[model samples]
Target chain A: MISVLRRELLAFFTSAAGYVLMAVFPVAMGLLALFVFPAVLERGASWFHTKELTMRSFFLAFPWVAAAVMPAIAMRSWAEEYRGNTFQLLLTLPAPSWRLVAGKYLASVAVLCLMLLTTGVFPVMIAANGGWEGGPIFGGYLGCLLLGSGYLAIGMFASSLTSNQLGAYMAALLACGTLTALGSFAGLAGSSGALSSMVRFMAAGDHFNLLAAGYLKLETVTFFISMAAFFLMLTALGVEGRRYR
Target chain B: MLNVEAISRSYGRFLALNGLSFSIGKGAILGFVGPNGAGKTTAMSIITGLLAADSGAVHLGDDEVHATPSLVKSRIGFLPETPPLYTAMEVSEYLRFCGEARGMDRQQLGERLENVLANTGLSARRNMPISTLSRGYRQRAGLAQALLHDPDLLVLDEPTSGLDPAQILDMHELLRGLAAQGKIVIFSTHILSEVEAIASHILIINHGRCLAFGERSALLGADGKERGLTDLFISLVKKRNP
Candidate 1:
């Protein structure tokens, strides 16, 4: 598994894909935080429009941003293996299926962390302004990591389903979009019924919303962890499924 | 010894490998020949544990491949038709990755890496990225990875496809050397003469059924005269198709 992780990281760095991805992720997120979201929400002249110095606007745009970028990060994970005929080599190696899945998943998450790390300027800016609290800021960054992990896991599973990278990206985008959109459904978050609560629990964005708001609930953390694990298992099963069929 | 026992696989309504069974002992080189889409790749995939046989199992000695894949896989090395090269990585880096992924210790991997690079005649191109390699070198890189682990069994599909005659001869010599070292070699090729040159045993299949499998001399010289594989192959295939 460590070898796989190292190779994956090396593959990313050695290819044009990694540098292009790094530039695109932060730039896309920066654009949204600096221009798109602030303008759409009519906050102020910029993200700093209000007197409050928080990353609230940034976290707010995270699910959408992650939905777009994490898939791009993961679209090539398995699709390239299938297209290049490398999966035949990989699957035949002595490692177990879970190890390969985890290795690839963690590599994407590592890339995600680096991508998120580049946005350190946002938090530093929030702190440099002298009115920022560490709690919500920390929670929001944690939320972004967790939410991005979930998005990437699903994206990897989508990639395993097809040899076409574009098709993988679109499938992942649609899946993540639906899960993120579920949070905005009428009365879903506000309702108290068991069915609505269940639906609310299924919305990945709702869990991210809690962490981004500095709630730090255990259930929310579990939701994100389980979401990542569940999709990772699905990706493993999809890869194994090819062996028999 | 490797034993593929009554293995069968199907894709929806079409049968791919239908109760295929074959075995080879240590130091034997078995040539696998069939027409295109004749389940050569599928059978190779099943033998390597990359694909599962629906109703049968491949055994390496006492352990079943499907039952203990991690254990069985460590003893088998497979090279598919395309070579499975990661074009972005250097030749040495890719081989190291393959070695480590197979769970070789650091010292063993380092030693084996040098040996395989030298053996495949890829020492000069060790630093070159696979994407920059010619078709023959890429195939050599693929064979290098399979040999990296020093497995007891080596299964290659179309091991010399797209190579020039000189490279093909080089590949035959490499396979002969591995077999001399007591490794079981099973390779598929479209070239009947290549099989006649290197294989001690030969298995011919058509439509996923074994038509003939025996020692090369016995199968070819059965009637007190040497018979060409091309004539035998054409007659056998025509019998099945017609």
Candidate 2:
């Protein structure tokens, strides 16, 4: 299992996919936070207000970006093996199925972390410019990590469902979109009370929003962890089902 | 040693193996000869625990193959019809990953990798990416991965399929060497000439059933009624059809 993990990690670092994700993701977020949101970027903005805007901007853009990028990292996880018939060789190994799944999952999560770390530039810029609250920035980074993990799990599950890479990408995008849309203004306006609460709880964006605001609710943490576990377990089950069928 | 009893598997409406049963003693090469879609690959997949059978059981010595598949799998090596190469990886790195996955320790893995690379004639190409290799080298790399752990049972699906004549001869000599080393090597192929050149025992399968199972000489016949293995195979398949 350790060897498998090391191999995956090595491959991620060596491949262009890893470098592109690590380099592009935070820079994109940085550009959006510093330049695109005029409401947040204009002069006379206090440090607290600027940091708050940065956090909001990151939270707002994370879902759409992750929904697009995480799938590219995960879609080839098992689908490429099926395409080249390497899956047979993998299954024949003495290691249990869960080991392979977990190894790949951890490697992808590490790459996501590399992507998330790029956003450190934003906090550095704020600190250099003026006084800002470190608490919210810390909480916001944590929220992004958890959110990215959840999306990756979903993408891994989708990838396991098909040998076609495009199908995996599309399935992951659709699933992530549904989760994001449920938290939007359009989603809340159409529902009320308990239905609204249920929708919010199920939406990843809703939990991320709370975390971005510096609220560490147990329910939100549990929701993200449970969501990640659920999708990873499904990915394992999907791969197992292929052997019998 | 291996034992299979009444193993049947289906893919929805298609019956791939119907109550198929066979057993081989330790260190014996059993050639599985069949026409296209004769369930040869399916049977090997179940035996290697890569696939599951709908009914029946597979046994590796005293252990049930399906119930305790990991234990059975640790002792076996498999090469599927298509060589399962990760084209992005270098040959040496791929073999190391395969060796460790089969439960080899670092020292043992290093020694084994060296041996397999030497035996499979893959030493010169060890640093090259799999995608850059020729068809013959890719096939050799596939065989090397299967042989990395010095497995007790080698299940090869068309080990020499898609090779040129020279490569085929090399594969024949390689299998012979493996069998001579007291390793049980089972392979499936449609080429009778390959079988005649290398196999000591043969199992002729047609339409998911074992049509003939015995020594090559007995199946080919004697007493001035000598016929080539291809003629014998064709006759057995024809007899089953009629």
Top candidate on lDDT is: 1
Error of 2 at A212 (Å): 1.2
Reference-based lDDT, each prediction: 0.89, 0.83
lDDT by residue for model 2 over A72-187, one digit each (tens)?
88888888878879899878888778888898899888888878777777777667766456666777778888888999999999989889999999999888888877777546
Q: Give per-model TM-scores.
A: 0.96, 0.94
Q: How much is the lDDT of residue B5 in candidate 1?
A: 90
Off by over 4 Å in 2: A37-54, A185-194, B222-224
TM-score of 2: 0.94
In the range A191-227, model 1's lDDT, one tens digit per residue, is 7877788778788888898898899999989998999
**Cα RMSD for predicted model 1:** 1.7
lDDT of 1 by residue, B1-242 (tens): 88989888888888988888888898999999999988999999989999888898899999999899999899998989999999989999899999989999999999999999998889999999999999999999999999999999999999998788888888889999999999999999998998999999999988888888889999888768999998889989999998
Please list, in the order the candidates appear, how each scores on TM-score for chain B only: 0.97, 0.95
lDDT of 1 at A202: 82
Error of 1 at A210 (Å): 1.5
